[model samples]
Target chain A: MSRRPSPSSSTAVPAARYLIGIDGGGTGTRARLVDSAGRRLGQGEAGPSALGQGVDQAWRNIRQAIDAAFLAAGLTPAAEADCALGLGLAGAEVATRRERFLASAPAYCKLALATDAATTLAGAHAGRPGTIVAVGTGTIGLARHADGRETSANGWGFPVGDEGSGAWLGLLAMQIAQQAFDGRSAAGALARAVWRTAGGSRAELLAWCEHAGQQRYAELAPLVFETEADDTQAAALLAAAAQAIEATVVAIDPRAELPLALCGSLGRRLEPYLDAATRARCVKPAGDAIDGALQLVREQIRQPLAPGIP
Target chain B: MSRRPSPSSSTAVPAARYLIGIDGGGTGTRARLVDSAGRRLGQGEAGPSALGQGVDQAWRNIRQAIDAAFLAAGLTPAAEADCALGLGLAGAEVATRRERFLASAPAYCKLALATDAATTLAGAHAGRPGTIVAVGTGTIGLARHADGRETSANGWGFPVGDEGSGAWLGLLAMQIAQQAFDGRSAAGALARAVWRTAGGSRAELLAWCEHAGQQRYAELAPLVFETEADDTQAAALLAAAAQAIEATVVAIDPRAELPLALCGSLGRRLEPYLDAATRARCVKPAGDAIDGALQLVREQIRQPLAPGIP
Candidate 1:
């Protein structure tokens, strides 16, 4: 079933000399390199490699990070044929993007790929079934069950979804600021902070917002945190975000069996705002998405998916 | 004081032989042609002329409609020097855009310009001081008082504001549909309809939403109303919409004293859901935005703004 069996694989025993685990998202990509025995060798970071953004860009970033990782290990960059790689990337859930990404990959001893949320869960729980809510520029909750079935909550993307994400927080802040501008609400600390960041005048705000996307909106999220103490409306928004997180947790793991991990750009920041019950379910992550990617690659090397089956 | 004082202005009294009133919004533009005596002549409609969309496109559509209006009047298209014009155009509140739009004008006998909301208010009360809540692709409340001071609420634009608007309803429905897809909520009628319109598959949804704007979101609004009877969530969304409308009304007219008229693509449709007390202030509009523009032009012809002051 192999079109290009490795020269080393002809003996029927695998000869992978390297293992690399990669975590990629909207902001950046991280690669962790290890020996065949799973001992850490080197680590590298590169620019954003979210698959949906562009498969070519994703691969380029991944390759750059991989090269850096090998250099950090004090070796010439290893050949793709000698490496087994696992990638947990943002936007990999979109089947078409993932396929295009996979098709363009360099032939390796083995490869495994999944959405960043999936790998986050795997890494957080040390390969066991668990739940993870990642809230950054976007937000989503994912759970892996004992039955190997997976469920997810939120993570609906830009201006429409991502309920408790940084973008969501920023959008809510803007709503309040707009109402303030119209004199429908008080121009409180939150409104002032938001207006200052976006612009002060109606014309300025409209122009700034006209072409803004998720990242632009998320840039405003921090203002909410900074002004919450002095702005009741800001505090209310945080409370709502906390509620949205709790709801997502409940949705993903109704029985609360899976240990929950809230980790992303915004997730950990929101931890204190979460109610005690939801916080109680939260556990320290055993490892990160990179470690999960390592675990996934190890498994894939043991049992490779057939060529052309991805 | 106009740079191009009408040839007729030199006659000691304004001698414009014809008048035109234009109402322009996101979806289309309408031009109403009337005689110098203010008698109805003819009317014509054309493509969208919202200034925010594009100044060139707005002018092109306005000119097309104006030409059609003149033809419908069974007269040769009048020269710019012979026609006084009034325009109520969307996005006229953005000072810079309004400036750009006015700067590109054709130099008619006399020109009067205001936001569509202002002209709607002027028209709804037959040029008197009153309140109008116009809800279509977007929502806003505007009230002109006897003292000439004006108050407005909402209409904060898309993705963040314009609460209770068609776009808002569509956005809320899409939010629910996303949760349903993620197993966070039941797929009620609203969700099903939205998913169908947006594409049911996750990949399809993501691809569709990747580039959607305010108009794209507004396209899904009718589904909320269509499914309200079968979906409690849809009903609740409508109830929330009605509440938003009421809040705007109360925000603009806190004393509840002004005669309120609900007229727009969605304004009257949401009326039945308003509270009885709020509905008690409802009044039929005296005329449409075109009439208000006509009235505004009449005033401008009587006393022109100083040149370069717009």
Candidate 2:
């Protein structure tokens, strides 16, 4: 529901001209509603929205965020059919999970779905055709062709891959921590910081390799970077991380001369660490994914899908 | 307990002129008894010898190994009173646990204790003044001076620092496995081998990390290396491991060209991967750690520990 005048229930059947865009992620789900004028009518947010974990959890959060926005805008629940939803969900790349999400679709005016990376691309180009490289807890390269073709590379989970990602950096930190603990490698303050941060006794640490977790490991990565000011191992790990990032870029469209966007929280945080060549390879996007979603929604209302978006 | 009669014992009351060497490690514990003539009297083996995890189990294994050697030579347990034990144990590196082991000292005629690394050094140069760079499940460089001054580097632990050891290699393999799973890396057969070896389910693997233990990790190292034939990630890991080994050597005694004695199962397996310069830098011992322990026992029997050994 929006603060605007109600047209859905009127006998005249006035057309509703607005769309809702959502960026569904592990941390939280964010929703923005915009009309044909490109003005935001309402915005909302809620908890974890990774679809692969489960659809119930994902939609629950999405609905919560949307409901909050609608309530604040003084709209009634009866206005639900006046809006279309465009969702960019994390972990939607899996075929089975995507199918399950499509099957359980809400009875909105219209709904469309795509992977988080694809949304990131749409965001990068403001719904236009371009490529985006996201470096968060994981790494992924995605591109949109003018002819509607899409391609992707690298976005593996941590341990073996996830180049230039939080997981990659975290794995390297673990290596240095082990060396310092055993007296094989010298870490000085870095070792003490890691021990304090990781929260385990020496005996417990002796058994750390056997019982480590993703969150526990992910927690140590920032500490490694923090210690890079003086610790050799930490410094080396950072350098290695930087190299991995560069390699990922090279792997994707080796000659990225056109507009290329760097997306994700990690990309922003590690921007300074990126080499000159890699930096030169990127171009700032005109608008983000949410803006792209808004633009998508507004266009659909003005000139509805030719064949009704099959 | 020697099948061959000892010349010294022939004098009726046996003068203890021989020594027993015990090398207790994660895989197993081994004992060797040698006479004054540098001749082997008997030898024995048993399992789970690390003190911290299994004191009762370790003692049980030790007693079995020792008893078997004597029985094999048709000797009575009463003869145990005439033997001195020179023990080098794995968990001796842990301060509290080592102290506990020392407090519960087994009933032997006489004994001296140190880390398995220390005993390995004693075996390498027959307790003479020299350096030993040990590469096993972990890597450690130890140097003993004439005045008993000792210096060590590396052997930090796996997932932190182990550098060029089995645990180091195994952890690297896991990183590749994770990468392959995410599609950010391609590990081919090596990835499948690890999945099979580590238990097929990712959730099971996640759980395994909570308490996988050292032996489980050490066992997977060979599989990592075997995958190098076709897996890019495995090859990269091996190359990185080789570089780490070189870095460890440099950290040990950069200036002095000391005799580097490489030992351990991993060291033997990675001989081909090590660079020619690093190979030339090493002085490959003629025997393994157990043989070295046996040699030390034989030498000590021939010429007692020149006063200071006690």
Candidate 3:
């Protein structure tokens, strides 16, 4: 949705009018608009902006979302250049992709970039010391220690690592569908669901996979949750997914000293499947990734964060 | 290696100077030349000729090997058109690829085509009824019943089905490398071998996968066999592969009545891992896929079979 700042907010443009915080991931991009005084102005969103999907596509989606946020804020497109931008994006850890993403920058007053995992941790803990397990289209666990030393787990990519992620779950589901098609396994409820969506015949399934990527596969993940109640195979998949999430929880904070929060839509949905030990460590996130992105630019520009607003 | 027919065989030109049988797969192509009287002449080899790779590449490799065979036999390239050609090609099951391959046929006097799996089954039984599991770069179990009915299992494609094939083994090995890199699993010998070959860094690994296909992954499969003795993970992968092969065996012949032959290099290597019950159904093939391809055209052209020669 587009958001436009009110006339009063636009009038404050030169001093503190616009701050755009972007959370760009494999599935979509979200932009949160705020004034320099930390007042929430508006929010905007666009399609996938993961640099790994290609730098050009990432830039296009980011620009679209930034423009959307400006529109939502009641500001003209030209006002975007006056806004400070903080972007926490997927694939930001890869040096080459990160470099390319930054290199293709559009005009802005100021800008900062970091991995989405980093911002997720910052947002979950509200700039405090805690760990976050992000389980959206992908999965990653990151911890920001009180000492400022950071550690991470997973976040590897689709079809390989990123265990317990939506993509991983859906990938495994596809494997099951394939096995069923080959008569190596039975066509259970989950398989039926996959077949219905992916095409029933082997040739059709192959054609479906020919163009499928991480985002397309992740779209199938909801079936795992939807069918888990009645299908043993689906339940097993969910259990394995939970185990993967638990591994990330332990891998990032083996000592169990840090407060942990599941920070993505799927992560929160997988909550009931977690072990008691992991559940005990879980805490509600104080802020969202957008807040952390905003916090990122605020720190860089030395702007004051509204007291206790987060 | 190229095989050229002897001068005496070349003299029999109009009647039955040459017959070429080709076994073409994802890894490489082989051409076998024989005279009208069914006497073995020479053999030639070339690179991958799988039609799914591209019709042009397949035709290129086939032509290279055919020319090599004619050259080896002390015959000129011009003699190729006078030969009867029979091709057992991987990806022949893909209708589009098969159509393209046939449409691009050279001026061979007579030509016939079938899937490599079908040819393997025919060759394994020397034109009799039997079951064959061909597990080279890809895997497929096919059975030709006495009644002329056929059944198949697996062979869906690489990185999907294909079960215990070389590419499947290598693809699984890649997964281990990825999981180890992500700290989701320990780095075992298999993972170490993969990292050494694929590159040690995450970016390097991702780059390795960027251009990797079935053939590239199959190159890493030998390590699974080489390291299985001292590495539990590698052993586990082999055991799983064996199980997949066994599943294919059962799927194709539930009654275990048909004589079964494992037709690929990996399939033979996995023989020792098969259970005694599954192994009991196994038999050495009477001929290879090249032999079957010739027999196919020999039947089609109503050529007299040399008595008792398979």
**Residue-level lDDT for A48 in candidate 3:** 90
Compose the digit string of candidate 1's lDDT tens values, residues A1-310: 5465453343443578999999999889999999989999999989999987799999999999999999899989988989988999999988888889989999887788988888888899998889999989999998999999998888879889999999999999988988888777789999999888889987777777776778999999999999999999999999999989998998999998888999887999999999998999899889999998999987766654444664
Q: Give the TM-score of each candidate.
A: 0.89, 0.60, 0.88
Tens-digit per-residue lDDT, B157-233, candidate 2: 54545677787777667656654553445648777888888756544454444355455666778987787888777
DockQ of each: 0.65, 0.20, 0.41
TM-score on B-chain, cand. 1: 0.93
All-Cα superposition RMSD per candidate: 3.7, 9.6, 7.6
> How many residue pairs in model 3 have overlapping backbones?
14
lDDT of 3 by residue, A221-276 (tens): 99988888878999999999899899887777778899999989899999899999
Best by lDDT: 1
DockQ of 1: 0.65
* lDDT at residue B232 of model 1 (Cα atoms): 100
Overall local distance difference test of candidate 1: 0.89
> How far in Å is the alpha carbon of B271 misplaced in model 2?
5.0
